[model samples]
Target: MPRFAANLSMLYNEHGFLDRFAAAARDGFKAVEFLFPYAFAPAELAARLQDNGLRQVLFNAPPGDWDGGERGIACIPGREAEFRDGFLRALEYAQALDCPRIHVMAGLAPVGRRREELKATYMENLGWAARQAAKAGRSVLLEPINTRDMPGFFLNFQEEAHRIVEDIGAKNLLVQMDLYHCQIMEGDLAARIRKYLPTGRVGHFQIAGVPGRFEPDVGEVNYAYLFGVIDEAAAQCGWDGWIGCEYKPRRGAVPYGTGEGLGWLRSPVLPGV
Candidate 1:
C-alpha cells in the first residue's frame, strides 16, 4: 500500500494547531505535510511531531504575505534576495522537523511580464534554492498550481513544470504533481504520470475530487481507478513515497459521522492493486 500523509492544514480548522496534530496521530497517520510552519517556533513544531510519532513528509518554503495573496516569490524578478531569505528560513524549520523535502512555491509572475524573463528568473532561483537544500541533505520541489484555481500563477501546467525542471538540471530539484490541478489542466491523468515518472520529477502528490476539491468520492475524478493507476506507476518506477490527503472534509470533521463518503478511506486499494 502507498504510504499516506495527512495534510493537517486542511483536516481540522476548528481545532487548535496542536489539537489537529493530535487528531492526525489518533487517526493512525505516520506522516504529515503542512503548507507553512512559520507560525510556530520550529522547535515547538518538531516536539509535537516527535510526541505524535509523525514524520514530516513535506512542507513549503515560506511565502511572503501568506495571508495577503502573495502565494510565493521564487519566480519574481528583483525579489531574489527576499526569496532566498524565505527559503533559508524554511530550511531551518525543515532541519528541526527532520523533513526530507521542502516545496518551493512558484508565485505568479507580475502582469505584463515577459514569459522568457519569468522563466529565466524561475530557473535561477530554483538552482540557488536547490543548492541550499542539497547542503542540508534535503530535496526541493516545485509545484504547479492550476490557473483556474489560482489565476496568473507562473507555473500552471505539468509540461511547463517539466520544462523548468529540465532547464534547472539539478538532481535535487523536482516537481510536485497535485492531482487536483492535473484534473483541471490535463484530462489524461495516468498517461501524464507515466510521462513524468521517468523524468523523476514527481516528488510529491496531493489528491482531491475534481470540480469540488473535496474528499475523493465527492467529484467525478474516479479516485478508485486513479489510485490503481498510481499504484501501477509506483510499482513500475519503484517509487516509495506518501500520497497526501489534501482535501476538505465534506461536512467538517464529525467524530460520529456515518456514510460512504467517510468510508472511502477504507475503500479497498484501487482495483488493479
Candidate 2:
C-alpha cells in the first residue's frame, strides 16, 4: 500500500501540536508531517511521536517572518547569516525528531536583482545547508510554491527547480514536488513526476485541490489517477515514499463530516495492495 501521511497544520486546526498528533493517530494515520515545528522542543515532539506510534515523514526549516510576508530568505543576498542560522536550528529539531527530510524555503528574491545573481546565491546557501543536513544523515528538500499565492517567490516551477537541483550537485539536496502548486503553475503533473523520478531528486509529495486547496475529491485534479501514475513510477524505479494529504477541511472538523472527509481519501492507491 502507498503510505499516507497527514499534514497536521492543515488538519485539526482546532487542536494544539500534541492534540493534533493524538487526533491523527486516532484517525489511523501511521505517519505525520508538519510544516514547521520550531515552536516546541524537538525532544518533547519526539516523545509525543513515540507515545502515539507515529513517524515523522517531513517538516520545513523555519521561514523567518512567516507572518510578516517574508516566507523565506535562503536565496536572498546579504541574508546568508540569517538563512544559515534558521537551517541549523531546523537541523537540530530534525535530529531529535528523527525526520529524514527538511524542506528549504527559497523565499522571495529581492527586487531589481538579476536572476543570475539570485540563482547563484540560492545555490551557494543550499550547498551549505545540504552539507549540514548530510552530517546528520538527513536530506534537504526544495519546494516549489505557486506564483499566484506567493508573488515574487523564487523556485515556482518544476523545470526551474530541476535545474537548480542539478546545478547544486549535492547528493543530499532534492526536489519536493507539491502537486497542488504544480497543477496551478504547470498542468502536466504526471509527466513532470516521470521526468524527475529518474534522477531520484524528487524526495517528497503533497496534494490538495487546485482551485481551493481543499480536499482532493473536490478539486480538478484526479488523485486516484495521480496515485496510479506515482505507483507505476515507484515500481519502475523501486522507490518507496510517503504521499502527504495537505488539504484544508471544507468545514470545521466534526464527527459527522470528518469520516466522510477522510473516507474520500481512503481509496486504495494501488489495487489489491
| Candidate 2: Cα lDDT at 147 | 88
Question: Per-residue CA lDDT of candidate 1, range 122-238, in tens?
Answer: 899999999999999999999888888899888888898888888888888988989999889877887887788766778888888889888887787877877777777888888
| lDDT tens per residue, model 2, 1-273 | 457898998887767667888888888999999889988878889998999999999998988899888978888988899999999999889889989999989988889999888888989999999999999999999999998989999889888888888888888899998999999999888788777776788888899987898888777987777787888788889878888889888873554333347766666444421
- Could you give the C-alpha RMSD of every candidate to the true structure, in order shown? 1.9, 2.0
**What residue pairs are clashing in model 1?**
none
User: How does candidate 2 fare on TM-score?
Assistant: 0.95
Worst 10 residues of 2 by lDDT: 251-260
